[model samples]
Target: MTVLSQLVSLVFGGLVPGFLLGLLAFRVKSRWCPRCGESTLAMPPTERDR
Candidate 1:
């Protein structure tokens, strides 16, 4: 029973959070345009800037 408890704690406390953070990082990185290496959500340049 003690070993089972420790295994559960290790999985839930460490692995779950680590997996979630990695997934979030991957999602955020995917938002960038690969060719230009710019964020896909970046605003278009206005006439004033041209």
Candidate 2:
């Protein structure tokens, strides 16, 4: 019972927040496009390479 509780806590305390933070970071990063008003990740490599 203790082990199971620990596992649940670890998932909720660690993985959940980590996943949320990663999602937030991705959203923030993708939304920032000062140059072209589009996600840089969506740009073609050739366009950015030059």
Candidate 3:
């Protein structure tokens, strides 16, 4: 009983969270462009002095 309980804790508590976090990481994209290394589209262009 004790060994089974420990195994369940390791799988449900530790492994489950880690696997979920990995899955989440794949779905979410950061604000920056990875290829060009540019700031996200939200960034504004610089203004020139007249």
Best model number under TM-score = 1
Error of model 1, residue 31, in angstroms = 2.1
Q: Regarding TM-score, does 1 or 2 come out ahead?
A: 1
* lDDT agreement with native, every candidate: 0.93, 0.84, 0.77
> Candidate 1: which stretches are off by over 4 Å?
42-45
In candidate 2, the residue pairs with backbone N, CA or C atoms under 3 Å apart (3 or more residues apart, or in different chains) clash, namely none
Q: Name every residue pair that clashes in candidate 3.
A: none
Kindly report the root-mean-square deviation of model 2 from the true structure over all alpha carbons.
6.4
lDDT tens per residue, model 2, 1-50: 99999999988899888999999998888776877777656655686688
Cα lDDT for residue 19, model 3? 92
Per-residue C-alpha lDDT of model 3 across residues 1-50, encoded as one tens digit per residue: 99999999877898888998988886565656789877665745567632
Worst ten-residue run, lDDT, model 1?
36-45
Cα lDDT tens digits, model 1, 1-50, are: 99999999988899888999999999999999989998889798999999
Sort by lDDT, best first: 1, 2, 3
TM-score for all predictions?
0.64, 0.50, 0.45
Clashing pairs in 1: none
Top lDDT hit: 1
